[model samples]
Target: MRRYLLQDTAQGIFFVTISNLTKEDSGKYWCAVSTKLSIGNLFDEVSLTVVDDKTLATMFISAC
Candidate 1:
């Protein structure tokens, strides 16, 4: 598996894309955005989850 860095946007949003996702890729990821504020740096946290192929299939089935 390879870790890919998402491009930073001017809108203060960051994302990461994984290619050729696998079963082992299923996990939680932490994403944060930082910017300088009046007092100090401000941080916003976003959580990411990569689903294994099997789990994704299950999700699709359940959704239907």
Candidate 2:
């Protein structure tokens, strides 16, 4: 499967999809929007964690 996909859903709106995630995929990511001025750039940072399906299931079951 493709590792990454980027799409422009609407004006000034975007989406990113990371497929076939693994533990190694966990890390910091950045999203940025560019403008004419270098200092006008916008940025957002995200921390992502990928867990196995079994682990997620266990978490859900334990929470119930």
Write candidate 1's Cα lDDT for 24-51 as tens digits: 7665544443446575554333333555
| lDDT, candidate 2, at 51 | 76
List residue ranges in candidate 1 displaced over 4 A.
1-3, 38-64
Name the weakest run of 10 consecutive residues (lDDT summed) in model 2.
55-64
Candidate 2 Cα deviation (angstroms), residue 14: 0.7
Sequence-dependent TM-score of model 1? 0.47
lDDT assessment of candidate 1: 0.43
Per-residue lDDT for 1-64 in model 2, tens only?
4567677755666666676667877778777777887678777776778876212211101110
Each model's lDDT comes to 0.43, 0.58
Error of 2 at 28 (Å): 0.7
